[model samples]
Target: MFLKGKTALVTGSTSGIGLAYAKALAAEGANIVINGFGDADDIEAERKALETLNGAKAIYSDADLTKPEKIEEMMKQAADEFGGVDILINNAGTQHVDPVEEFPVEKWDLIIALNLSAAFHTTRLAVPYMKEKGWGRIIATASAHSKAASPFKTAYVTAKHGIAGFTKTIALELAQHGITANAISPGYVWTPLVENQIPDTMKARNMSREDVIEKVLLEGQPTKEFVTPEQVAAIALFLCRDEAAQVTGANWSVDGGWTAE
Candidate 1:
């Protein structure tokens, strides 16, 4: 329980990688603030479960992250409840698949606001608390798209690329504060969201299930495997360790060598 008494705030944490990040931190005894939209019952269940991970406190924040004022309120709640976030994981994101010409302008704005700008809001709000303590961890769930691009995903790609640069800049600024800022870039992570798309993809392309997964999905992943949420969370956990104090401004790739090409 190296993180006992610390607090972690994870955006988009109701499920998938975000939830995994929360669970990992909770296991190490960190108080938790989970943010995202989900079934109320499910969110509460997860929140209750987190508190039991190591007898730490856990709360839920349904803050609409695209709104800066809501982000501020959420941060204030964290401060009021647990002395502010010691670890901030900017993981809330959404995806829209379409050519740039056909992409909805509203979606482009939302992607930029949620995936990119929300990180800035959370980081800016949490930095003061961290600076006061002289210790903190900031991790962003950037994607393989952050390093390599794919067609029909202009907004997502743009936002992720922005995140890579944002992570680097903040890392340099916080380096002397005993804080580490890093981004984790994972490729084709296996989650309910990814799993749900498989059936549709298989039917659309007249491909077998295995073909959809291997050829269509894992095409760029040299290992031909879906990176698990736990794997990405492990890297986040490592970044919070005292040993990683100097490991800032890095884009840690858990992408099965997708960007190695």
Candidate 2:
């Protein structure tokens, strides 16, 4: 295994795309630190399942991504437990859909802190170790909103756009250091987050659930199919390959042509 002795820290990884990333990495033989909130039993199950993959070690962190101190502590724990992080995926995020003027200030701040700034914190702490090791991968779960905007998602859009820029800056800064940085932008990912947003979207647009799913959620996606978490995970796996060493400083879109228009 190419990553037999490596370690990965993936935020928001108790479920969905983030979990997929963790599993994919563990399959390649990387120890995993899965972070997020969920039922204690369920989280423990996921953590145990990850450890089963290729017999990799796996741990769980309940760190609050919105808080820099906790993020630092989480990174320290990973470094202490696994020697240091070799793969860092900043995937924790949240969304609020009120109109720009009506968006709560607290919501905007929380979204920015979790979605964009958390990556900064993790990267800053993890980079020194990566630099010393002379290799690393930093991937962020940005969204199609990073490139194209939709109405009523001002905070999410802003945060994702910020991630795009941040990824590029990190890539350039580490270009000669054997470290790669990138963001994966997915559109209409079929996850609990999207499923849960349907009712709110229906209420906001005064439409039925079906209408919200088709006309609101899938409207921008020409494929009219939700991007699967596994599909995005495959791309993340590819980026860590030796063949992908030059693929940094890029925003890889798994949006099914949402931004092609």
Candidate 3:
């Protein structure tokens, strides 16, 4: 219960990697504030589950990440309820994959707003409170694309690369305040969303299931295995510990050697 009195706000936590982060922090006895869009019943279930797991308060916000006003309202709610955030995980993101020439301008705007600008807004709001307390953790979910480029994902790659830079800048600014800021870069994370895409990819490519998994899905990942959300969550939790006080300003890659190459 090292984090018994801490409060963690995880964006896009209704499912996938974000949900995994909420659960991992909740297991360590941190109060949870989760946000994202999903079924009402499902969201409540996750909120209740987190509360039950650690006997800590858990709340959900349906804040639209693309809008700063909604993000402000969400942060205000967290402050009113929990006295302010102690750990902030900016993980809400959306992707639109198309060739640069055919990319939709609206999609580019949306992706930048959610994946990059939202983190900036949340960090600015969270930092004042963290500085007042002299301790905090700020973690952003970047991607292998942050370090390496791939075709047809111009917006995603740009936003992730921006996140890496944002993390480093803030880490240096808050270095002596007992706060640490870092980005976790995962490659080809295996989620239900990713799973659902495989069949369509196989059909489009006319490849066998194994070929799709290896040649298409896990091609850039040297391990030939997709990174798990739980694994990323574990690393995030580790960054919250006293042992990780000096681990700021780093983009920790959990990308199965994708970025290593």
Q: Estimate each model's TM-score.
A: 0.95, 0.98, 0.95
Candidate 3 residues lying further than 4 Å off, grouped into runs, are 192-212
Report the lDDT tens digits of candidate 3 across residue range 1-261. Answer: 889999999999999999999999999999999999989999999999999887989999999989999999999999999999999999998876666787899989999999999999999999999999999999999988889887667898999999999999999999999999999999988776567656655655678888978887789988988899999999999999999999999999998898777
Note the residue pairs that clash in candidate 2.
none
Model 1 clash number:
0
Which of 2 and 3 is ahead in lDDT? 2
lDDT of 3 at 49: 95
Worst 10 residues of 1 by lDDT: 196-205
Instruction: Give the whole-model CA lDDT for all candidates, comma-separated.
Output: 0.93, 0.93, 0.92
Residue 179 local lDDT, model 3: 97
Error of 2 at 62 (Å): 0.2
lDDT of candidate 2 at residue 229, scale 0 to 100: 97
The TM-score, computed over Cα atoms with residue i paired to residue i, of candidate 1 is 0.95
lDDT of 2 by residue, 107-158 (tens): 9999999999999999999999999999999999999999999888888999
Highest TM-score: which candidate? 2
